[model samples]
Target: MQTNHDHSDVTVRRDGHIAIVELARPPYNYFDETLIGHLVAVFEQLDDDASCRAIVLASQGKAFCAGADFSGGPTDPQMPRRLYRHAVRLFATRKPIVAAVHGPAIGGGAGLALVADFRVTCEAARFAVNFNRLGIHPGFGLSVTLPRLVGPQQAAMLLFTGKRIDGRKAVEIGLADVLAPDGEVLAHAVALAHDIAASAPLALMSTRATLRQGLADAVLAAVDHEASEQEWQVRTADFAEGVAATAARREAVFTGK
Candidate 1:
């Protein structure tokens, strides 16, 4: 049996005990406030449905998520704060999530993938924490999630360098749990979700809740610090240089000024 739901930028479908939540933007799916809100709503609904024991989070795009689309949004200072407010809600979800990371997951995009309990990726997948490269502090709770996943040393390396690593390297560093063959990432993620779903649902949720206890609060706290830092960094000359260099696909020349 199957059931489907369509949101503005996301799709939710159920196949027996596994719920499939897919980001619908094509090419490079750059998340913004609306997309994140839709995801939070979908996860909340799935959490209430006893039939959904687990979820496979995938995307219809060359990049799982490139990051935020900063070019078009309202330039209001409160925009990112509003977005992170919803992001914290995503971390509060109850069900287990397996993220199918087929391509680049950079900056906040990487944070989205980290929201999952497990990540399945292919060699084609690339992961990076690029906030420093953008002359901003990491957001989406990456300051908490990245270090928790990869250990502080490895997380610091990725954050400081803003270098991208392929799926194999990501797994080696504990950033990804499973590495699937190219083109089979989503399939592997769904299979993993099904395996989780096959377990007794009540026990699974109970275990998951215990394991993830205090995580949402930690993320919320980290976001507050991150947002505070980014608030000042966004006003720096280095930020302008970084943005221009990124757009031109070149290395940034940052001056401490």
Candidate 2:
């Protein structure tokens, strides 16, 4: 195994033909513009490495990613726009990604997970698209990717309700590919990456490219609309109440302002 030293928040290690990219933020791998940018850089570097045929995205901590930490200061309406731009770069990378969803992937965190080609999750893992619950439109190109993975109706249900589902339910609903045992999600994800890496590298890239053709473009367009909606929604009274309610750990009382 060879360790590729890079940015602080993200790290990459090589195991034969697969590159394991890990998020170093622990407990809750909350993302921001800088973390997303580092991820895009690492993924692009992996794309240029010929020996790296597949990538496994894993995170250290109790939760895979608990979403953005909007705890302090006034919410920056433009942050999502900037972060979404960085996210587009992630979708543009030309490498197979298998995400290890060992824990919670909520809100934008779930969007990050969807950037991968496949996801391996455990029964304890939780998946949710809670942007609507946050009183904002979905960002991170989830409008296109979620529907692409699970179809329009299922995507609508998940987006509109902002419901959290377990790994078994996620697999059943097509949100995740494989369901691994608790404590072995990363191992299974790496094994899946290895399986994908076994194929001819050029052929693998070609087939993946063909399959995901125009996906990045679709995400680009979707995020534009999503960001526009979010920009306005974030200014609403309901959004304010939603954030407060979440921080208080209670159901939100939305006034529909």
Candidate 3:
């Protein structure tokens, strides 16, 4: 038996003990506060459902998530705070999540992937925490999550330089747990989730709780600082130049302002 739910750009479907939650905005699933909120709601529901032991997080898109849609230029100045506020709820979820990243997961998208307990990716997958490149401090709790996965040195390198890394490099740096072929990322992720789901449910939840203790609180603290820094950074001239340069596909020339 399968159960499906439609929540605008997000979809949740159950397959036995495994739940597959997908982001439905194809080509590039750029998220906003509403999208994050929908995801959190789905996770919360799945948490209450005893049948959902583990979750596979996938996307129908060229990029698993390419971060926020900046094509409309700067969004509401308060948007980052609101978006991160919703995002913190993801960390409070109870079940394990395996993210299938088939393409670029950039900026806040990278933060979204890190919210999962594990990540599955392919050679085609690209990961980047590019807030610095965009002339803003990293948000979505990446400062906490990225370092927790890849160590502070590697996390700092990625965050400070805003460099994009492929799946192999991601695995090497501990950003991803498993590697799959280009088209099979989601399959592998689901398989991993199934393995986790096969374990004794109570023990699994207990072990996971111990392993992830205090993580939600850490993300909460991180997002607060991230949001505050981003608020001021967004008002800088360098931020404007960064956005313009990215849209133009040119190198940004930032002046300290």
How close is each model in CA RMSD to the real structure?
1.4, 0.9, 1.0
What residue runs in model 2 are displaced by over 4 Å at the alpha carbon? Answer: none
After TM-score superposition, what is the CA distance of residue 5 in candidate 1 from its true location, in Å? Answer: 3.6
lDDT of all the models against the reference? 0.89, 0.92, 0.91
TM-score-best of 1 and 3: 3
Clash pairs for candidate 2: none
lDDT of 1 at 151: 92
TM-score of each: 0.96, 0.98, 0.98
lDDT of 3: 0.91
Question: Across residues 1-257, which tens digit of lDDT does each residue of candidate 1 receive?
Answer: 56476695898777789988989998889998999999999999989999899999999979999998655422355666788889999999999999999999988999999999999998999998888897888899999999999899999999999999999999999999999999999999999999999999999999999999999999999988887787777778877777777878999999965
Identify the candidate with maximal lDDT: 2
Mind giving the per-residue lDDT tens digits that candidate 2 earns over 135-177? 8888899999999989999999999999999999999989999
| Colliding residue pairs in candidate 1 | none
Taking the tens digit of each residue's C-alpha lDDT, what string does model 3 give over 1-257? 56576697998887789999999888899998888989989999989999899999999979999999877776677889889989988998899999999999999999999999999999889999988888899999999999999899999999999999999999988999999998999989989999999999999999999999999999999998988888888888988888899889899999976
Q: lDDT of candidate 2 vs native?
A: 0.92
Question: Which 10-residue window in model 3 sums to the lowest lDDT?
Answer: 1-10
